[model samples]
Target: MSKKFVLIYGDAFVDYIAEDQSNSRFTKFLGGATVNVAAGVARLGAASSFITVTGENETSEFVRNELAEEGVDLSFSQIVPEKEVSGVYVHLLENNERHFERYVDVTPDIQVDFSAIKNEIIHETSVFHFCSGTLFHPIALGTTRKIVENMKKSNVLISFDANIRPLRWSSEESCRETISSFFNMVDILKLTEEELFFLTETTSIEDGIKSMQQYNIEALLITIGAEGTYAVLHGEVVHVPVEKVIPVDTTGAGDAFVAGILSKIYLEGHPSTKEDWIRYIAFSNRLGGICATKPGALSAMPRLKDLQ
Candidate 1:
């Protein structure tokens, strides 16, 4: 069966990339974890859809148009009040690393109504992508739960990224609670080395993976930056080496890695062996490595041709 990749319930951001110390020029790009992953999946020749909220302003219009051009569905995405702007963040680039200073408070103001496409699209998905940051917003949190419940009933494969932004949550304990609660519901999880230690409250990566074994997760992908990626598959762990690259910006590399894994699974089917898992991680690492070479997240994402 042909499968669809759907990214559910996340925010959209208009990122302003600063030119230099002169602060004379800036470029805007479509961003957000879900948006980056959605675009990455589509560029890899998969059927991708983004289920999120946006206002009817020019920035939102740019977002809608760009995703549509990339072949991501916006049918289920809702429009909020015109006065309410979509989230905006300033991307500060220094020494090939990126930092963000957000301007908007992403609260309950732009929560999506999943009911809009629940009956029509939820069951048709093969992979449902989730991010933990959405849980910080009251209404989006509830909406995320509703979507997950439906996905459970439909037996859709759920992939989650903690994507933890500490500033967004009320407290570290609360963040852990919200993220930990969804562990059992997800089929695949992607986490950075720091997030692994933070969420599991374990000092080492091995213990962190062991801590999540009680959950129903089938696979866990841990990205250790320059050290490459590790995947826990069928009780065995496999490490894949990353391609060396001179990075221009490393903003959404992890999100692109998530997209590569999902894209490979959608095309090749779920892996049954450690070797299969290794192959998938290698492809994912390549996509991520390529994304880092470019400046913006969404724009920097690789296409199928680029991967070739």
Candidate 2:
């Protein structure tokens, strides 16, 4: 069975983000890039789903409900019993300088059966995706590798977002090795300026694109917020300038952009040309701008109507 559309294959967990306003603390809402991107795809009115190991706790249950509400089909998640639901602990962000207190490690023992989810979703999808963050973990990484290989057998276009969480890969050497392995595997690669800097080991965007081209990647998106974004495909580079907006909470902006790109390509039936890719980047940037103007990651992720 060929996949219907996009299938996000890893890291569906809670992100307990805290923001301190003056002296008061508040939760920003639960988030994770993979889930956010999956929800964003659904918001784009596309056939997209998520596959990850979820805990059978209240938090996991809540996360499942939240994802369902966001329109992400949850049939692909593997529920792990007797394990604590995972969450990211935080301190406060003063002008985006997020000072961390502690990172709560509630991650369950990842024992997912890759063939099960792949048999159901990836086998029928046009694109299969996962971020680099979770691939750093042993069990999830190993299982995801198997799934990616299986997805390849079905001719699924593998998309990878090297959403490098600073805390996850602290060392530059570790960052280079892990991220490159991820790029080497995926057909499509998308990363922000910060992510490209780390993965390519180049402060220059040109150098970054040059490095990625060596991986035989079909497409590479270099997202530069506010200023706009650029994409490289088939040895040509195209840039899309962003539409300006005052943001309320810029949480899921990047994922929103990714959804926008994928929506244009997979759903709208656009060709993967240099011009088309640039147009998709602009379309995605518009989606990201809209998401930032809203409050939460899920809440801000706009639907197809919002795009118009």
Candidate 3:
């Protein structure tokens, strides 16, 4: 049988990353967490389908064209004339870390309609991935919940990445509450060390994971840059380390990691044993590390050739 595609749903943003620590010069690239993942999966030779809303303008055309160039299928996406694609300015800090400085969203209210998503797409999807980017809007939140509910009824593996952006949400409490609402419905959950503390309201990693025990999440992966990833599988915690790399840009590293995990699950099937989970997490860590060594988000994503 032919392998099923990894279905991703979220916004597509034009990232304006600063050229250096001075934060003066900027370069634009096609980005957003879900956009990076969709392209990353396809770069790894896995089938990927993206679901998002674009516009009829030049920027929207660029987003669609770039995604198509990266081998991402846009068959499930929509094009609305009034919808202006969002843009975010990223500032590089010490250690090549990225800080989201400002977000320019002309049409935050526009979102994908869940009811319009065909049932056959859901049936053919081996893995469905989403993030907290669109959850700040009520309409998008409701649509995400509806989509998750439908995916739950199917055999598709559900993946959620709490790609938290404080600038996008009205308040921290609202962001935490909105993201936590989908924890129980997701099969795999990915978070950064900071996002863990923000969501669980805890200072330590152990405390954060302890607080999240109430949710029915199957696998919880907390990515710590350079060191590695901490994965909670079946009730046991395992630390999966990665080879060190001198990172040039950390933007979209987490998205690359999520794409790696979801692609493996889609192409190879879900990891059944504890050992299986560790191997998958380790592979994802390598992908994230490789992405950081480069510059742009989607451009930095490792293709099959990069892995060799």
lDDT of 1 at 85: 38
The residue ranges of model 1 lying beyond 4 angstroms of the native Cα positions read 1-7, 20-25, 83-85, 90-95
Highest TM-score model number: 3
lDDT by candidate, in order shown: 0.80, 0.73, 0.92
Residues 1-308, candidate 2, lDDT per residue (tens digit)? 54477788666656655554342564745577888888888888887777766777787788788888877777767787765655665444555323334455555356566656636565567677788767656776788788878777776778888877767656768767876876666777888888787777789998888877787777888888788887777667888899899866677788898887776667766455666677777888899889878766666788988856
lDDT of 1 by residue, 1-308 (tens): 44555555578777676655343467778878888898888899877878877777677788889889988887777777553434545555456666565556544555787667557576568788889866887778888898888887888888999998886789999999998998888889899999999998999988998887787778888998777997888667778899899877787899889989888877888788788888889989988999988877898889988966
Which residue window of length 10 is worst by lDDT in model 2? 92-101
TM-score ranking from best candidate downward: 3, 1, 2
The C-alpha TM-scores of every prediction are 0.92, 0.91, 0.98
Which of the predicted structures, 2 or 3, would earn the higher TM-score when compared with the native?
3
Candidate whose lDDT is highest: 3
**What RMSD value applies to candidate 3?**
1.1
* Model 3, position 95: C-alpha lDDT score: 77
TM-score of 1: 0.92
Which residue pairs of candidate 3 clash? Answer: none
lDDT string for model 3 (59-93, tens) is: 99999999999999999998889999999999999
At residue 266, candidate 2 shows an lDDT of 72
